[model samples]
Target: METPNRQGRRRIVVGITGASGAIYGIRLLRLLRGLDVESHLVMSRSAHLTLNCETELRPADIHALADVVHANGDIGAAIASGSFHADGMIIAPCSIKTLSEIASGVTSSLMSRAADVMLKERRRLVLMVRETPLHAGHLRSMATVTDIGAIVYPPVPAFYARPASLEDMVDYSLGRVLDLFGLEASLAGRWSGVAAKRNPGDAAHVA
Candidate 1:
């Protein structure tokens, strides 16, 4: 797929819910900043608690990375309406509570409202649900969202990158997610399967 023109930077709404992996949301912001994408952020109350529990960075520090930060309780934010155009929205480390809200079309907070707007506007919506040992409810919720064209991406690691640090792994995961929206990123390693496909005489070998 062709990437959108960069004349104006793409706008992506990012929501950090109460999930345990606040690092995913933080690293996603950093990666989006590096790509020059416009980020609109919303953090739930539970997300604040998780942030305090997981990382040393303050809320202000996290807000600094986004172009605009809206309160999670603010359903009046531009991102919460379909009239506000955005390239897409991502709910990094989406909590089960938030996921259930979205799946059920309950838009109580800015995060859930923005996701609903994304879907209704026919824009891309990616949810990195951070739950394990899924129950039937969780599976059904996922299926419901998937039926509505939202991507349910689990934060799976890529061993092929041979990530040497936490940042490296985060970058790989974020890059892969961004790629789904046709965004180009150099943070993730590329596959070079041509070498494996070649016969000995087919090409000059590299050591």
Candidate 2:
């Protein structure tokens, strides 16, 4: 990680939606905790269901990982306002529905509302989109957010890490996203590229 967050605490807003890769969001929260970064979490209703279906973690367990938690409907939460300073916001395993809502500036949920705040405040907003085989509309929506300074980071696995387990792949993806925030949350085995397997690849070669 380079350059401490301009603001204090290096606070981050995390949104977990109803996407297949619930583990990405979970792992992100864990990494943030380990890195001692402040995290504000907001989850969609469907995320609860998926959390149960995908992993052993319960709602309380996930909530415990974050320093602050906001309801999906509570648009009035502190994070929803641009006045509330944060390093950035990340929607790990960002569902297509959630992505669309933010892209359209709908702000239908607090998740999107907080993301909207990131955009209007000119703060980084990273969306780890979980879907595959994107269509034209998906691409357009991604382009829309990108046009507005948001990053559409899909959770594609990086094999260079030589992950021996599923968790390794998840951490690798989360680490890459965290790079956008300049946070050192990568799991062991970063590709230095000097050897391409030492300290992890630089951002330019990360893709």
Candidate 3:
């Protein structure tokens, strides 16, 4: 059975790597806040640049959405240590650069350090690799990370959710990531499977 405090609210770590899809991290923060989950965020330098180019919101605004925001340079922060317990860590829009670093056990930045801690502590680590056209090196890195118990989740939207807008798509993707950590949220449209037949006439015979 899960502990009451642990089930009541999840402590999730959100890391935004140097990838093009900054919206994923931003949408995750918004949804996590709405769900009353405690979120810790770490944004890479390249992620900050992408945020400036892609979204109108500044880093401060994004930081405000999270319960705790840590500098990417702060390697000594509590989050970098395994003693600081958390439900999981999500590296949304994880770039190939960051993925390679984590795969190779390089803890140069706080985001990477937190991921290292998660791996060492046997905590959930979800890497949302956002690159297109994967190469052999990328596949090898993904395999290496998966072998070490890290999940390689690509930002693939589900059409079954019937997403009407970009926000809906973002929510669906982030919701799936949260599901890995056993956190519940209504970010995505609930899956009800295929609709029931309207009538007997709707049924067709196959030859």
Q: In candidate 2, what are the lDDT values of residues 1-207, reduced to their tens digit?
A: 222345556788899999998898888998898988889999999999999999998999999999999999998889888888788899988999988988899878899999998899888999989887889999999999999989999888777678899988888888888878887764666666763354544566655
TM-score of each: 0.88, 0.88, 0.89
Candidate 2 least-lDDT 10 residues: 1-10
lDDT of 1: 0.87
Q: Candidate 1 regions off by >4 Å?
A: 1-7, 194-207
Residues 43-110, candidate 3: write the lDDT tens digits: 99998899999999899999999999999999998899988878778999999999999999977999
How far off is residue 151 in model 1, in Å? 0.3
Candidate 1, 1-207: lDDT as tens digits: 222434577888899998989999998888888888888999999998999999998899999999899998887888878778688989999998888988999778889989988888888999999999999999999999999979999888898778899888877888889999878788876987644476777666555
Give candidate 2 misplaced runs (Cα > 4 Å): 1-7, 194-207
Where's the lowest-lDDT run of ten residues in candidate 1?
1-10
